[model samples]
Target: MATRIDLTLDCADARPLAAFWKTALGYVDEPPPAPFATREEWAAHFDPPEDDPDAADPAGGGAWLCDPDGVGPRLSILRVPEPKRAKNRLHMDIRVPGHGGPAERWERIGAESRRLVAAGGRVVTEFEGHHVVMADPEGNEFCVAAAPA
Candidate 1:
């Protein structure tokens, strides 16, 4: 049977990435920390209970951020001690808005790819169907696909 989808981002800071993605994907923050009356109040509200299954970034790596408004999958930013080693065995293929198919699209990808590379990402390659391969700052691969109709 087919199941739902979840997106995981391996990054250094969960909040920043989550926030950036929230803006990028137009999603609200996962959830405010329970929204107490005051920041102090919320900060003060700590539970010393056991079996609540809370253990301080237990992923030891990343945190899960969600978008209830989005039809897309939930996103988790994991923090790993070691870094990504090689080319991704799996990659994300995203579609963006391009004027032309291959030539013009390749030009746009070239410009966008430059920006991504400048932002610490690399352009792994390009393909026929108006697609480009990109990686995030942490070297995890994703794509900037031509926007759909």
Candidate 2:
């Protein structure tokens, strides 16, 4: 069987970043495990003892997102004390369907770029008819590209 994978991102805050990613990738907040009413309720099952110095906060600061269509990998945004200091070694490319000719493909790419920018992403550079490099609200770099013909 093929293996499935999940992607994780460390951020100063998780909720907003998850929101931006959800907009960029067409993802939705993943629900709590079955039989659990909410994420907090599911987490309560693993709560640490009161005396433990490293006990997790009941109000956690992470967010989990998944593709609504169930084809893409899950995304986990974890809250961390440190901020992003450098460029990401790896990044995601948001691919839009490439139909018609060059002008049409570029139009589709541009449209997606504009949508992402409105959703808290910024354009880094544009490759004209090729692709547009963009950054999330936290400055994590990604790209908006056209899918294969």
Candidate 3:
């Protein structure tokens, strides 16, 4: 059987990172688990005397995002005390698929890159005729590729 996997990112703050990723990946905030109708409902019961040790999140302790169509793996952001000190060894490349012709492909890539920039990501460098490297708000590096065949 194929193994299913979830992606976890360690960061300084999870909420904004999760928000940025949600928009970047076209994902939605993952719904709360059973016994809780919504995330807010779950948060409401935080750290009471009888609270379940396994079920507590203090405000923005963490965040989860998932593909709306349930096709992609779950992404969880975990807040850590330390900041990112160096470049990422494993980074994600955002694939912006090409549509029709060469012109159309480049156009689409440019549009997506621009959109990401407006969403708080900044362009780092461009690989001619290929991809553009970008940094998330927290300075994590990732690429916006020219899509896959």
lDDT of 2: 0.88
**lDDT for each residue of candidate 3 in 1-149, tens digit (9 for 90 to 100):** 89888988988878888888988999999999889988767767665445434335544467888999998899988777688999999899888775577767777777888999999899999875678899988999999877666
lDDT of 2 by residue, 14-77 (tens): 8899999999888999998899988777767885667843246543577889999999999998
Cα RMSD (Å) per model? 5.5, 2.4, 3.8
Residues 1-149, model 1: lDDT tens digits:
77889877766665555555554455654543556543334434665246533335333434556667667777767654456677777766654566666666667656766665665666777775566787665667778766654
Full candidate order by TM-score, most accurate first = 2, 3, 1
Q: Which portions of model 1 miss their true places by more than 4 Å?
A: 32-61, 98-120, 127-129, 147-149
Candidate 3 overall lDDT versus native: 0.82
Specify the highest-TM-score model's number: 2
lDDT top scorer? 2
Ranking by lDDT: 2, 3, 1
TM-score for predicted model 3 compared with the true structure? 0.82
What's the lDDT for residue 53 in model 2?
37
Native-to-model Cα distance after best TM-score fit, residue 11 in candidate 1, in Å: 3.7
